[model samples]
Target: MADHAAARTTRSMTVPLVAFVAGAVVAVLLGVLGRVHDPTLSGTTDLGFRTVIEMKVVLATVIGALVVLQLLSALWLYGHLGRRPPSWLGTAHRVSGGLALLLTVFVGYSCLWALGLEVGTLPHGEPVPLRAVVHGVLGCAVFGAVVVKIVAVRARRAPGWFLPVAGGLLFTLLLVVVLTSAAWYVAARGWPGPAGY
Candidate 1:
């Protein structure tokens, strides 16, 4: 019984540790690549902005912070589950969750905005309707998910399951957002725009 309990504890810790390490590695690699290549954007405007790489850096930082906060909150919640923690732990969990949600929304918006501007919907070049539409839809979905999470947490009807379920969903969404954004970045760089400018 004791060994089983210990194993469960170890397994719980494994998820958070993996999240943290993965976030750190992605952040470092993206940051280094951004510095080395320093790609430019040129289309409707003859101006250059390292927009994609910058977006990656911003997303990485936000996601990294979110992962750390989520891990901390998870650990606290684990303790509370075993034996009720102090009032402050509960408050901390709420605060951390709120921040994570906020950051996730920001990442989503920034990604869509970057995509729109780069693809020429605004004033740059011929617009790629498909990419724009996909980005916009994903951004809205992320926002909607955050709203649902907020409502669930505040209701406090079934916190034990609610929190974990929400966290898992948000984590999955973050991964998708990261992967898609990375894919779009690569595609943008590979294909030349109006001026290649």
Candidate 2:
């Protein structure tokens, strides 16, 4: 009986252990990629910078909301909400998660293509703002967390908590990215670039 109990504990930990290693690898790889990857600058738009910023902000906000829904759905599926989950709960979770991922991919590509990793508009000698630096770091982290979440979800051996943990981390990183960039842009330049300025 004792041997069986020990084996079960070991088995349960195997997935969590794998998840931890994968998460670490993901974070490092994403950071390196963000640093070394050159901006494509292929995203063409007749609209001005302010317009682009506004559109990105709107999309990000929507994505963030969807992520919240995803979290709730995950909780429901996991029975963490302390109630019976609806039949559609799983479908809702999957759909919202997919939508969020798709939107994030588009926004992330556009951002890197247009803005690169550099922080501010100041001259070369000027110091980079702390907010920009934080945003950039967190941006890379967002990619890592999302990848980790995906891997965890697909890992059949992984523990159920692994998915929720990874998803939560991704959501947090995304919120920081949105807050540091889009929210800051809106605050600095209003919703639409101060009306033709």
Winner by lDDT: 2
TM-score of each: 0.46, 0.78
In the order shown, what is each candidate's alpha-carbon RMSD?
Answer: 14.2, 3.5
Which residue segments of model 1 deviate by more than 4 Å? 1-49, 80-92, 114-138, 158-160, 182-197
Which ten contiguous residues of candidate 2 have the minimum total lDDT? 41-50
Top of the candidates by TM-score: 2
lDDT of 2 at 47: 43
Q: Give a tens-digit lDDT track for model 1, residues 75-194.
A: 666774466666787677667666766666555444434343233353456675765445444444455445444544554333255556656665555555554555565556553333
Q: Which stretches of candidate 2 lie over 4 Å from their true place?
A: 1-14, 37-40, 44-51, 119-123, 193-197
| Candidate 2 local Cα displacement, residue 158, angstroms | 2.5
The deviation in Å at residue 127 for candidate 2 is 1.6
Q: Mind giving the per-residue lDDT tens digits that candidate 2 earns over 132-167? A: 778877776777777788777887766667777888
Residue pairs of candidate 2 with colliding backbone atoms? none
Candidate 2, backbone clash total: 0
